[model samples]
Target chain A: MLKYTEDHEWLNLADGVATVGITNHAVEQLGDLVFVDLPEVGAQLAKGDAAATVESVKAASDVYCPLDGEIVEVNEAIVNDPSIVNSDAQAAGWFFKLKLARPADADGLMDEAAYLALVG
Target chain B: MSDTTELGKTPLTALNARIGGKMVDFAGYEMPVQFPEGVMKEHLHTRAKAGLFDVGHMGQVILRAKSGKVEDAALALERLVPVDVLGLKPGRQRYGLFTDQNGGILDDLMFANRGDHLFLVVNAACKAQDIAHLRKHLSGDFEIEELTDRGLIALQGPAAEKALAKLNPDVAAMAFMDVKDVTLAGASCIVSRSGYSGEDGYEISVPAEQAVELTEALLADPDVHPIGLGARDSLRLEAGLCLYGNDIDTTTTPVAAALEWAVQKVRRAGGARAGGFPGADVILPEFERGASRRRVGLAPEGRAPVRGGAVLFADETASEPVGMVTSGGFGPSVDRPVAMGHVATSLSEPGTRLYAEVRGKRLPVTVATLPFITPRYKRA
Candidate 1:
């Protein structure tokens, strides 16, 4: 059960914790992830708000929150080696975990089939 | 507005789109910024293996003397640039600048002697103006021709020679800065053993019709991948190479840009030389006494990348702003962010400490030695 946003963020919600990261398509578009600024733990985030900043070789992009919640954990490993997102964008590349305000918020996100259509 | 045509398209446009290249508008042309492999991968690939680049956007011009003597044409060109064109051997290339009367660089370009004709490559955006300026100043005995329909491709990397040798074995034997007219992949092309990426590479000028075919042929090799403008900038930046408009512009002098090496000593020695070029008065003296501001490399502290237009402070108090960043980005090969800027002469030392004012916060920065990563040009 993977979900996606139009901005290319993917969220995996399980047992009230949602793990998030950018898609492979997004990584390809960004090109050579260099530095990433992760959100502080316990910081409250609203849906569509910027959760982090990712700088690539060419430009910088803002990673938006998929659903309103508070950041509980962040993957610092990816921050040190941003290429993890390029190599394994879906699994180990998870950016952060959010404690969702409501489980229904995840329902609004696009599923794998829907996300594929949007990206295509 | 309706009469104006669309921005020019290179022969590789269709191929780039097919390969999922992220296209962007650059110098009045729609060019790929990067590809599916990403900029970092493409950049490292170029350093380790071979990376192909489409540089057809650059302007190509030919200069021939009406007197039919190569020396006459060389003399005519010497008037505009400070390089000793007469001393340049055929098949060799030299980097130079076209300066205004006040010594400000109008454009930076590469000139090569092709036996009977002199070949020039000017910046894409400045080509029209360059031709107009040369036409206005050049003597009637010299003839100028533009090769707009030709496509330019650069093959760069440590393995570039071996890759190019596979097609034209003679190219591998050519030394640095040498040029040859050869038929590559069945297309007659001008091949030069010079590139901007600080690597042993070749820049091939092919017929427009054969451009895509040549690109496809090269990409078919496992070592060759189509790189985009994004990686090109990073590669040049790592090599401490200047990007014309950003690093050195019309307002920047060659002396300020630390490019005096491009100007020969003989041209600066004589008070009244035979060739009467433009901006001789200002340029000649700067050669003796260095310019006030100099371009230097800066490495900022931490992972926060400093970018262009960021004001640089000389000291800790963040006192008077010394200069600004011209080009700044994360160098994948170097594993850190590097930047180039025009700073005051006193603060241009390799280890001088400085601060960059990013969003009102003074970020610590230090003057670092250039070529942030040493260029791996093949000398032998």
Candidate 2:
């Protein structure tokens, strides 16, 4: 299932790990995705904290963490080719995988239905 | 202040909105930064086919001399710039710089002698200042008029000429740097064979009232699609054209910006004779002995794009910043992250190794040859 924050970041929690990426709405606003600065594996991040930087053709935006966690893995493929975010922002364009520090906090994020309404 | 009231709108604002463009503030104007297809798609399309850009934010001015002799008008213009305007033939254009008393550039502009008048196109942000400066210094005999109600559109690509020829057949016959008065879609216009992107293109000036209609007519063609400022920036960057505020400014000299070529030999020879221009003493010497810092193109080792204000280091461990990035982004044509920066003169040569300090991480980069992609101007 998908969960989202007010900043437009989405997290797909599966088992104990969550896959993080930005929403298609955010990517569409950014125009052209040029570079993705990946967070190092094992780095601890706090809820609502900046985790990575996404540079587009015109500007750069920070990707925030949805919940406190430790980064378990990052998508090196997206870093090498950022157009993945432009083409598939929510799927194969996943930024990184994070092991949640508090599983219960995931419930606080908005569901896909709520996110759609909020973005609209 | 109310955002809508504060932001200046282009003549084609309504049309851009109708086409689903993402409008953003650019140099005080609410212009389209990109369309639904996105900047990368727009940029790549322009490279392969024709892309129409609404560059109506740029200022257009006409200068008429007292005698109406193009040569005298060119001389009067030479006082404010270092270009060899006297030699500018009718129908030809030259890129020039408006300088301050210290030889620093106030703005880089294009001057075209259109038989009966001198046409100038200045940057959007510096237009007012440039006009005021010209009025204050120019002779009373000259008349300077600002064409604020005119809209400028650029159609650029490998097939730009062919596409534009369908609208104005004479456009294909025009040579590079040539300008002429033409009527398209029943509107009187001035079309010039010049553009910022290193592609064969035309810059057409039309009345503001007919801007939307002309744009629609051009877009009606299967080859023409609306482009935005986002793609415009990337295309110019790939072509190695400098952005005024980022790549150059009042603090930057033409010499440091690697624009000395714009200063012709006649200007240098007539430096002392031509007394009114700014910073003649300081600029002329730098022409002979190069500036301390020069603008150079940089190609990063990987996909990590370096942005403006990023520091450059000689070694990887966050050494003292030798220079700073000016304009940088992914060059759509080259499919690599390219950047322009001002580095120490000694390190400005092609193939020089450097490191860009981006967010505390040292990214390896090398000085690369410019016009990162070759320009395709129609010379003949």
Candidate 3:
């Protein structure tokens, strides 16, 4: 299931794990991504904590954790070449995977249609 | 810094918006932050070929001596700045700084000797204040006329010569720091072989009415791409040029900003015209003894871009900040993070190691040389 956060993060939930990445809207606003700083794979994170950083040629911004979870896996491809995220932010540019503390919390997020409305 | 007040528009605002420019409020003017190509590409494009920028919002003014001599105006102007204005020959422009009475920089500007009159271009945000300052000081001796109806555009990069030379053949003969009156596409323009970008280029000042026509004509050349404010800042930063409010301001002195080169020997302590300018008492001594703090280049260890206001420390465990970053970002040409800041003069040498606090982490940085990239100005 796909969901989005008001902070411009997207989640793709599968079983108890979810793949997290910033939305395309955030990519457009931040301009070209020059660097990405991600958290360790096994770190524990609370909702609203800064989990990652996305830096452009102009400025740097924090990518927040949408839900309390244990970080399961982190993507290293974008770290090597951050422009991968700028080119394809949703799929190949996914930042990390987290084992959710409560799987049911995904229902609280906005769906694709609601997320589009929020951004609009 | 807020948009509550009415925003001012440059002569090329409509054209900028028409070409997919992301317009934002910059110093009260609705300026283009970047175009559809984005800042990264625009910056790289300028370095590779040519990029045209609309700087019409910058303040342009003319200073004429009431006594009918440009030397008199230059001498009167020298009372406020620490530069040798009288020594500047006709058709040459020099960088200047406006100093307050107590050894602080009021503003950094460019002044050109345009034969009978002196042409001055000041920062947009400080223009109104600077005009008031000049009027308060030199109105009785000089006639100051602000050129509100002029449009300033910079055509920059290695290929800039090829593009502009197509319109005016004489431009190819000009060298760096040379300012001349030239005609382009039927518009009478003041062309200067100088720009913020470290590339070989020209800044052409045209009449407001013909601004769009000149901009459009330049873009028609294959080598020319339209650039925005985003690339402008990056280009200048990579070139080690200081932005007025960020690098040097009302609080920083010229010697502290590492701008002693602009102060010619004639204006220094032992010269004939020394000790006449504002703050000469405080600034001149620094020429021999030096300032306690100095501006230097910085290279953050990794890819994370360290930006303005990031506190710098001697080490990760240091409590007090040793200095602070004044201007910084990813240098597209350098292909890495680059920065500049003021640190204690003791640690200002190149190769000195320091740390910048970023996101609760101390990122290691090295004190490097200025102009992250080698300048390609046609000085000869």
Candidate 4:
């Protein structure tokens, strides 16, 4: 199932792993992505922690951790070439995979309907 | 995002919105930050073909001498700025600086001698202060008339000449820094063969009512694209041109800003006209002996751009910062991250290594030569 954060991060939960990436709305507003900084694997992150950074030609923005978890893996492709995030923000642009602290906690995140309405 | 209600609208605001400009508040003006083409493409387009910029928000003024002689106006203006204004021949312009009592730059400006009067263009944010500075000093000898009925625009890039020549063929014969009264699209314009972008271009000041017509005529060309502030900043940063308030301010002196070349030999020590402008005591000495710190280009060793306000250190893990980046970003033309900053004079030499602190990590950066791309001005 997919979930969203008010901060514009989207996440997909499968088994005990949650895949995270910035929302398409963020890519639209960021103009052009020139750089991306991803978190290191195995780093313990709390909810609301700044885990990654996305830099456009004009400015930089932080992508926050939606829920407490351990970063199990990160997308090195986004770091190598950030334009992928602007081109495919939801699927191929996923930033990291987190081992959830509590798998059931994923239910607390906003659903597609709620996320869409909030962004609108 | 600021409250757009209070933002000032330029003459080109309506036309800008019609062209997909993402209007934003810049220096309190509702100016475009980018269009649908985006900053990266807009910057590249300006480097390759042509890009039109609405610079109406900048302050424009005309200075005429009370004695009815242009030389008197030029001489009176010399007391405010450290440039050889008297040596500025008619039909030509020169880059200049307004110095303060402490030898710091008040504002950087361009002044052109139009045979009978002087034309000056200054930054929008500092326009009021700059005009006030002029009035307070030269009111006794000159009539300072701020051009409120006009708007300014620039057409820049490699194809800028070809695009602009389509409107006025005489523009093709102009050289860098040349200024002339020309007719474009049936409107009178003060056209100068100069621009902030490192490309060969022209800055034309036109009647406010005719600005839209003039802009539309230029954009009608296949090569000219409407650019916004985002691309303008990147282009100027890549060109090693200083943007007021970001790169040079009251805290930075012209000498330390690596703009000594603009301070002509005629204004220096032992010259015909020496030590006349404000802060000459402090600025004059720097020509012989350099300042404590100097501005230099920075090449970030990583893809992440070392942007303005990033603190600079002499080495990794250094607890104290030796300098700070004044301007930086990805250079679309060079296809690499480029930046400029001020550092301790001893560490200002090209190839000298410095570390910039970004997001709690120290990134390696080298002091590189400025204008990451070689200047492309069509100098005679």
Candidate 5:
């Protein structure tokens, strides 16, 4: 199931792991992305922790992790071409994959419907 | 202060909306911060081709001499600023700063001697204060006429001349800082060969009612794109121009802002018009001695952009800040993060190393000579 955080990050959970990326709404607000800095593999992160930084020409913003986990994989493609996140923020722009510290933690996040209501 | 409060809109507001401008509230005005092309592309486009900017939010006024002599108005204006206004020839413009009794800057402006009168353009946010200042000081000798019915637009870049000359052939003959009245598309206008972008450009002041048509005419050129306030800030920063509120303020003097060049010899000590303007006691001495701190260019070592208000430290690990970054950003033309701010004179030398604490990380920076991108001004 796909879930969203109040911070505008999205998480997809499967097989005790979760894939995370910024939502389309967040990417739209950020405008054109010029640089992306992601956390390295094996880096530990707490829920709501800043795991990446996305920079546009005018400003920089931190992207927080939705749930606590150890980073098992990172999207090196988005790091190399930051604009990809602006073009395809949901799927190909997935920032990192985390081995969930607690499989049930995803339930605490907002589902797609609730997340849309909050953003609206 | 309420979100429901109406923000001031320029004459080009509707046109901006039609072009898909990303609007934002700036200094109480609903202005476009950027367009769909974004600040980076808009900035690079201005450096490469021509860009049309709606500068109508700037305050334009005419100071007419009550006694029918231009010197009367010049002398009245000289009392507020340190620049030598009496020496300004007809059709020529000069950059000036309004100084307080303490030698601090009140506002920076461009004043053009229009033969019989003086034309002044000041920052929009400070317009009320500037006009009131002029009235309080010079109302006795000058009639200050606020040109609220006019609009201002700037055509800037390497291709600016080529683009503008197609519509007004007289623009090709105008030299830098030259201001003259011309007719564009049958609309009487005042065109000045000067701008804040540090490029060879022209600022056209037109009738507010005809601003849309004039803007549309310029935008018809293939080289000209509608640039917004976002690229405008970055472009001026790259050129080392000072934004009144960001780079300079009520506490900063022309000497401290590295704007002593704007102060002519006649206004300095031992000159013909010495000590006549406000704060001469403290400002004139800075010419002989020096200011304790000066504004200088800062080039960050890496890609992480350090924005304004970032505290600067003397060493990488030092907690005490020696200065602050007044204006910092990514320079699209330079392809790096460039900044400018005040620093102790001891640390103001080019190539001097310093550290800026950006997002809790200490980033290395070097004090470099200004104009991160060299100005491509056309001089006669």
Candidate 6:
């Protein structure tokens, strides 16, 4: 299942783990990406806690965690080349994989149709 | 975003929208912050090629003698600013400042001697007050005309001359700071080989209705790309240019701002027209004895950009701030973060190590000479 947060972060959950990344809309709004600072593996994050930071030439923005989890893995590739966040934000540009402590924490998040309406 | 109804639009607003400019509200105007290429790419592209900017929102005013000596209005304007305007030759431009009674800068502007009149271009945000200041100070046989029907455009970069010469061959003959009247695409225009960007470029002032056509003609060249305010700000910052309200304000003087060069010796204490302009009492001594605080360029030790208003400490553990960063950002051309700020005279020397508190962390910064990138001007 795919879930969205008001801060423009999106998560895909399967087998007690979730893949996390910013939405395409958020990437478009941020313009160009120059740097990305992601949380380290084994880092514990609470829902709504900041997990990553994305900086463009003009401004910096924070990416918040949608659900409480322990960071199991981080995408070092995106850190090496930040443009992937702008080019393939939803898939190849994923920020991290987390083991969800409580899977039901994402139940209140918006679905794709609902998220589109919220953004519009 | 406030009420969009209150924001003004430039003549190129429609064109900016068609080209994917992300609009933002600036100085009560709906201006383009950047295009699809984004700020970083646009900034880099300008350094490599030519970039076009719509500066129509900037104020243009003409001061002409009602019926007197041609230098009469020039002499009148000299009373408000601290520049050698009376000695300005025809078709030449000079950077100037409007000073208050307390040796503070009201606004910085560019003025060109056009033989018949003195042409002035001031900051967009300070235009209203600048016009009123001119009217309130000068009372002789002079007429002030706001050229609202005209629009301004800047084509800047190393390749600017090549791109501009394709349309108007005369532009090739104009040297830096030279102003002349020319015809572009059958529309009469006033062109000057000057710009805010630290590059050899031209600023074209044309009839408002014909601006779009002239812009398209410049864009027809392969080397020219339309840039927005985002790149303009970064480019000027990298050049160490002082943004009016940010780097200089009502509280900053020419000496403290490190703009003593603009206040030529001819206008100082011993010159021909000394002590005539405003604030001569306090400003003259600063030239003799340097100011206590001065503006200096700062290169941060790392990639994290130190932003404006960042507090500065003399040492790594100082409890009180010694200065403040007025304009700071990432310099795309230099590939590092650069900044400009006012600091104590003791700490203003080049290579003086200072600490800038950014996001609650103290970052080491080195005081350096202005202009992270050297300016390339075509003087000849």
Off by over 4 Å in 6: A14-17, A39-45, A69-76, A97-101, B1-5
User: Which candidate order results from sorting by lDDT in descending order?
Assistant: 3, 4, 5, 6, 2, 1
Off by over 4 Å in 5: A40-42, A110-120
Q: What level of docking quality does candidate 5 show? A: medium
What are the Cα lDDT values of the candidates?
Answer: 0.86, 0.88, 0.93, 0.92, 0.90, 0.89
Residues A7-109 of candidate 4: C-alpha lDDT, one tens digit per residue: 9999999998999999999898997899999999999999999999988888888999989999999999999889999999999999999999999988889
* lDDT by residue (tens digit), candidate 3, B1-380: 54478888888999999999999988889899999999999999999999999898899989999888999999988988999999999999999999998888998899999998899999999999999999999978789999998899999999999999999999999999999999999999999999999999999999989999999999999889999999999999999999998998877778899999999999998898987878888899999999989999999989889999999999989898999999999999999999999999999999999999998899999999998999999997
When 1 and 6 are scored with lDDT, the better candidate is 6
Model 4 agreement with the true structure over B1-380: per-residue lDDT tens digits: 34546888889999999989999888878899999999999999999899999999999999999888889989988999989999899999999999999999999999999999999999999999999999999877789999989989999999999988899899999999999999999899999999999999999999999999999999999899999999999999889999999889888888899999988888899989988999999999999999998999999998988889999999997898999999988887887788999999999999999999999999999999988887789898
Taking the tens digit of each residue's C-alpha lDDT, what string does model 1 give over B1-380? 13375877887777887898888878888899888877888899999999999999899999999888888888888888877888889988888888888878889898899999899999988999999988988848889999977999999998888888878788988888898898889999999889999888999999999998888888888999889898999999999999988999867877888888888776776733432567777777777787888899999887867888889997668578898888898888988888999999889999998898864568888998888887777675
Task: Give per-residue CA lDDT, model 5, range B123-172, as digits (tens).
Answer: 99899999999999886668998999998999999999999888889999
Give the chain B TM-score for each candidate.
0.96, 0.97, 0.99, 0.98, 0.98, 0.98
Model 2 per-residue lDDT at A28:
75
Q: Clash pairs of candidate 6?
A: none
Per-residue lDDT tens digits for candidate 2, residues B27-96, read 8888998988788889988989989999998999998898888777888888899888878889888899
DockQ of 4: 0.77
Off by over 4 Å in 1: A1-5, A11-20, A42-50, A65-72, A97-117, B1-5, B269-275, B315-319, B359-361
Q: Which residues of candidate 3, in runs, are more than 4 Å off?
A: B1-4
lDDT of 1 at B65: 92
Ranking by DockQ: 3, 4, 2, 1, 5, 6
DockQ of 6: 0.53
DockQ class, candidate 1: medium
lDDT of 2 at B228: 92
| Prediction-by-prediction clash tally | 1, 1, 0, 0, 0, 0
Those runs of model 2 whose alpha carbons end farther than 4 Å from true positions after fitting are B1-5, B269-276
Clashes of 3: 0
Interface RMSD of 6: 1.5
lDDT of 2 at B35: 88
Native-to-model Cα distance after best TM-score fit, residue B136 in candidate 6, in Å: 0.3
